[model samples]
Target chain A: DQQVKQNSPSLSVQEGRISILNCDYTNSMFDYFLWYKKYPAEGPTFLISISSIKDKNEDGRFTVFLNKSAKHLSLHIVPSQPGDSAVYFCAASNGNAGKSTFGDGTTLTVKP
Target chain B: GAGVSQSPSNKVTEKGKDVELRCDPISGHTALYWYRQSLGQGLEFLIYFQGNSAPDKSGLPSDRFSAERTGGSVSTLTIQRTQQEDSAVYLCASSPQPYTANTGELFFGEGSRLTVL
Candidate 1:
């Protein structure tokens, strides 16, 4: 069973525009959510994360918002750059459980 | 040298052969993890190691899969009698600890792709 899901297979946006990627989870036990960006032939790289206690977190140009009631989360990239093009994955963990479940990634393409 | 490193970046083998993949976690990191990614699929959890304690191998797909972490630094994943279904990219990651206070973020190595004919 897929505990986490990213419905969009791919997305395209113009440079300097806002890019939004969405994710949803069915596990209520997951307390922490993270977003990772992966490039070709490389492993996923940590981008940003949010705790269950907070509804939103922002780092530089990346922002993550969580809606506990809806079991949904989103990653938003402002002023998207060509270099930001990559596959984005959403993952979740439950503290010491130490095992993270990932969603099928969304490939983002930024046209310059 | 600074981040997690995996060896045998690419491997191709015939069916019924066994394959071994290796991972070297960053220095001083006590937590290690292994995952597999198939084409057009998300990362699938395989195993986790913390220090000298036992590893969590719950996500292992079958009895043919086994892994071992030695000296709390390096790990090797072994697949026996490999089949075409075993072909995928294997990834390794490391963290300082299990919780958010010390090692919430995981540093991953470029995956090793295995192809079984």
Candidate 2:
């Protein structure tokens, strides 16, 4: 019962290029989604999030697109940098606090 | 601590031994959660606690697994007679607001890696 899924295990892109990460969920009840970036031996840092009511959310070079009807969302980083290389996780949750379900994670590597 | 803190970053225990992992959430946060993850695997929900409410332990794998939150701040996860399969990273997270249906974000710890030999 994997409610959230990130099919792509790894992604590679060149510096200053666009990096897109995809995520899908099976439970329509989920109304909030978030993305987190994790580095080796460190906690996952909060990146960005979107509510089901909105279709898109952006912050600086990071943007999150949500397609509620399709139960899918994606994170886009424009002009990706080497510092952006890390394991990105997509998590979803319903009304339950502290009960978010997480995807396996996508490892993104930016080549300089 | 400025963020969630988990102790015993790495632990190696023999099979059948018990182990305890600790987590200290942010000072003012109200919601705390525990999750397990294997290498290259997704986070697995283990338990959830909010304020003084009863914890949600539906995700716990078995009776051998138990956890408790004390003084509404620190949490301890104890595994009795740990099995080889019990080896995994234990992560703890906290949220300022109780994540309702509309919004919420989690602040996670680095996670405690457990190895059962």
Candidate 3:
């Protein structure tokens, strides 16, 4: 069973526009969530994350919003840049160390 | 040397042959993870290893797959009698601390592509 899901397979946005990626989880035990960005032929890198106790977290131009009641979270990139184009994966963990479940990933493309 | 390193980045083997994939986590990192991604699919967890404690093998797909971590550092994932269905990209990751609210991210390797023909 897929504990985490990213319904969108791909998204395209213009540079300097807002880009939002959504993710949902079926397991209620997940207490921590993270977003990762991956480029072609490279490993995924950490992006942003939020704890279940918090509703929102922000870093630089990326912000993550968590809605616990709905078991949903989203990553918002404001003024998206072409360099932001990559596959983004949503991962969730149930207060564990290395057992995070990942989504199928959403490919985001930013056009200049 | 710097980040999580996985060797045999590309391996092609015949069905029924055993294959070994290696992972060297970042120096000083304590938690290591193994995951595989098949075509058109998401990352599939295979195993996890922590310092000196028992490894978590709950995610292993079958009895043919086994992994071991030595000296709390290097790890090897062995797939015995591999099948064509085993073809995928195997990824390894490491973290300084257990994935928690305090440490929410992992450093991943580029991944080892295994092609079982």
Model 2, A55-105: lDDT tens digits are 999999999999988899999999899999999999988766358789999
Residues B1-117 of candidate 1 have per-residue lDDT tens digits of 698999999999999999999999999999999999999999998999988889999989999999999888989999999999999999999888864453257889999999999
Q: lDDT ranking from best to worst? A: 1, 3, 2
Show model 1 residue runs off by greater than 4 Å: none
Candidate 2: segments with Cα more than 4 A from true spot: B100-103
- Give the distance in Å from residue B113's predicted Cα in candidate 2 to where it truly belongs: 0.3
- DockQ of every candidate structure: 0.66, 0.68, 0.70
For candidate 3, what is the lDDT? 0.91
Model 1: residue A28 alpha-carbon error in angstroms: 0.9
lDDT of 3 by residue, B21-58 (tens): 99999999889999998876778889988788899999
Model 2 chain B weakest 10-residue run by lDDT: B96-105
TM-score of chain B of 2: 0.95
**Interface alpha-carbon RMSD, every candidate:** 1.9, 1.9, 1.6
lDDT of each prediction vs. the true structure? 0.92, 0.91, 0.91
CAPRI quality band, candidate 1:
medium
